[model samples]
Every structure is written in structure tokens, then in C-alpha cells.
Target: MNFYTVLEYIGMFLVFVGALFLFLGALGIFRLPDVYNRLQAGTKATTLGAFGAIIGIGLMRPEWLPKAILIAVFILMTNPISSHALARASYRRGIKLWDRSVVDRYGPYLREKEEKEGKR
Candidate 1:
């Protein structure tokens, strides 16, 4: 009905949304067919889920908002980078994609780079 109370409700809703994403992310990790797919599912989900839940808690607590925002920023910056690094490493190590995967975008890019370096 009032400002803080309204924030509480919104915070609760955000927390619920965050939790739902976290759950779906887990399911994706479990059900996805490959490392790249799983990494994508996990990273994207955790970023949104964690940011939502953290910001929700910050709203509820008020005092924690700055720290919450900081943590959320860290997650936003790191999650995708880390996931990309992991996927790149896996690719370099010759991890095979799922059999039905239709594209090998990175393969061509890598070959082009290799060809250029060899020519150098």
C-alpha cells in the first residue's frame, strides 16, 4: 500500500522470477546436449537470475543495494567472458560439437587466422 511495502512486493516478485530462471538454468545444464550449449544456458541464466535475486534482496534490505549492484555488475561482466573462455578452450582441445549441430562458425575463423599466420 505504501512505498516500502510496495518495494517489498516488487522485491518478492523479482526474487521469484530470479529463482525460476535459476531452476530453468539447472534444467538446461542437465538436459542440453553439449558443453557449449550447457555453458550458454548456465551463464545467461545465472546472470539474470543472480542479478534479479540480488537486486531484489537489495530492495528489501535497502542498506545492501550498493553492494548488491556491485555484485550484479561483476556477474554481468564475468559470466559471459568466463563461459566464452571455457568454450574456446574446449574447442581448441578438439571437443566435438553435437552431431546435428548445423554450423561451425569458429572453425572457419580459426582456419583463416591460421592461414594468415602461416603465410606470415
Candidate 2:
């Protein structure tokens, strides 16, 4: 096959792979007990999934490569930070954690803050 045809196949493969990740992320959102867990799944999975599709599109369409790359990079950089902020805000607002949560590393920090504020 031609080079462009090969690239098209690869791009299609990536799109399918990305779709799988999106599905998994959606499942996690539905199955996870807490907002944090849901956010974790949504942010990471969706980022990678979307990135995959973007890269695939870039590969398939050279003219669109620059814009796709820019978008992918932006998503990679911002997704985690947004998820973290959301989780922290939920925790601060006293949102209950998952029953399956084995540890809470942030609990100590939250407690310390509460103590300093005389709310503990």
C-alpha cells in the first residue's frame, strides 16, 4: 500500500484505541464511589484517549499536525492539574471518600489545617 494509506490505517487504529480508553473512563466514572476517583479516571483516561486520536489525526493529515499537536500538549498539561484541584476542593468541602479507599495521604494535611484554624 501507499504511505498515505498506511498512515490512514495507523490513524484508524489509534482512533479505535482512543475510543476504548474513553469507554473505560466512562465506566470508571460510573463505578467509582467518590468524586476523586471518578475525576482520576475521567482526566487521565480521557486525556490519553483524546491525545491518541489527535496524534492519529495529525499523522493522517500532515497539514493539521501542528494544531493537533498543540491541542494534545495543552490537554496533557492541563488535565492533571484540573483534576487535582477538583479533588482537593471536594476533599476540603468534606466530600466523603470511597469505602474502598485504603489510605488517605491528604488526611494529615487536612487535619493539620483544621487544627491550625481551631476547627479540629
Leading candidate by TM-score: 1
Clashes of each: 0, 0
Give the Å error, residue 64, model 1. Answer: 1.0
Against the hidden reference, what TM-scores do the models get? Answer: 0.91, 0.89
* Residues 1-120, model 2: lDDT tens digits: 999999889988998898899899999999987798799899989999999989899988988989999999999999999888898889888898988888888889878887999963
Q: Per-residue lDDT tens digits of candidate 1, residues 1-120?
A: 889999999999999999999998999999999998999899999789999999999899898989999998999998889898999999999999999999888888989999999999
lDDT for predicted candidate 1 compared with the true structure: 0.93
